[model samples]
Target: MEYDIVMEPPTPREFVHLRSAAGMRERSLDAARAGIGDECAAVTIRADGDLVGMGRIVGDGATVFQIVDIAVAPDHQGRGLGSRIMNELVSWLEANVPPSAFINLIASEPAFYEEFDFETCAPELVGMDLTLPTESESSHAQ
Candidate 1:
């Protein structure tokens, strides 16, 4: 199942659509629209111009930077698109972020991120929320 995967930088519009299709938590289109504005840059993988994978770096672009929205379409999963996206993001961080800056992500898969040098925060040092109140409310209402 080899396909021609091309990695290209993502525009905000394309990022929203691909993120939605990848089963990401639903966000308002306006929020998604505003999200990629200036603060973040994304890389997307496409096959014949159809999006297959994407990842983005989002934050203040200085002191606090978090990697967010890394996703690959189901059909494209098992290939190296996620790694490719991470590599690009990390490279960007290396070239751009200062040594004193903090980079973080709430990974979908801990093991996968570990390969890229991301480690889990120590339980004693950090608190985590598995689901936000809004997400919980939405689930309960449904």
Candidate 2:
């Protein structure tokens, strides 16, 4: 039987649900608001009208971009929805981004991303970040 998979650009609220359901990091409403904007290339899959998967390209349209928040709901996992999402995001990048643009992503399973030409910059380079302590935690530290 064929499934009804409708892919569309996701609204802000849908991103929140998709991210949480897919086990990605949570963002505050304001932070999420800040993340998605005119420059973003995003796609969401609706299975019979329910939002089941999503992916997005975030960063400067030309200089930098990151493939992020690729997620399929638990019930929808293993049906290749993640692959479909990546395909759409990569298509967007291919059509819109120039050669100088750098596309990056941090994947739990790097193999999945490798299918779309993603490579780890390890050894030659490393991914790093600085997480700020929450207010309560900082107060305790003080």
Candidate 3:
């Protein structure tokens, strides 16, 4: 099946839904609302008019950019939808972002992203992250 790749972020509702459907971490609607449409570049794929894949680049528009939210629906895995999404985002960055700008992403599958020239930052630099507790999490901790 041919998928339509659109050069735009998905709606907040669609973003939340597809993120979950793709087994990515769950994001609240409020977070989605605050995040969607803020990307330097974004790509969304639709199959038969239903959103099935998405990717985005975010950061300070000048010197830093991070690719995030790369997803493909479970049923759509094994297809090239994820690659197509990355192709669009990378192309946009290549055309627009400065050569000196830094582009990065946190990848679960390093092999996959290595195809796009992403290298591991281990042994030399460690990647760390922290997730702020949600209201329920905070209440439960007390």
Candidate 4:
């Protein structure tokens, strides 16, 4: 199936649904609504008018940037949609971001991103993250 890739962020509902459908972690609708438009660059791919793939670049935009939320629906995987999304993202970064900006991404499959020249920041630097507890979890703990 052919897809229409656009240089824009997905709607919050579409963003939440597509991420889950792509086997990624679930994110709250509130979080989606709050965060979707904060990206410096975003790509959305749709088929038959349904959003099927997306990628985003988020950060301070000037000196720091992180690629995030790259996803493609399960049924649409392996058709090079991810590559298309990445191509749009890399192209946007190349055209818009400054040469001195620090761009990064956290990937489970480093090999996939390596195709785009993303190297693992190991040895010299380690990737680390911390997920904050939800409201319910915090209340239960208290």
- All candidates: TM-score: 0.79, 0.86, 0.96, 0.97
Residue pairs that clash (backbone atoms under 3 angstroms), model 2: none
Considering every candidate listed, which one attains the maximal lDDT? 4
Instruction: Give the number of the best model, judged by TM-score.
Output: 4
Worst 10 residues of 4 by lDDT: 120-129
Q: Which model is ahead, 2 or 4, in terms of lDDT?
A: 4
What are the candidates' C-alpha RMSDs? 3.9, 2.2, 1.0, 0.8
Tens-digit lDDT track of model 2 for 13-76 = 7778778888888766676677665546877788677788887787877899988788888998
Ranking by TM-score: 4, 3, 2, 1
- Report the poorest 10 consecutive residues by lDDT, candidate 3: 120-129
Q: Which lDDT tens digits does candidate 3 get at residues 20-110?
A: 9988999999999998998888899999999999999999999999999999999999988888888888889989999999888888999
What is the number of residue pairs that collide in model 4? 0
lDDT of 4 by residue, 32-89 (tens): 9999898899999999999999999999979999999999999999999999999999
- Model 2, residue 89: what's the lDDT? 84
C-alpha-based local distance difference test score of model 3: 0.91
CA lDDT of 22 in candidate 2?
80
Model 3 regions lying over 4 Å from their true place: none
Q: Name the 10 consecutive residues with the lowest summed lDDT in model 1.
A: 1-10
Mind giving the per-residue lDDT tens digits that candidate 1 earns over 1-142?
A: 4444333446667777777888888666676667665555667777876778877787887898988889888878888888888888888899899999989998778899999898888774573657556756889988
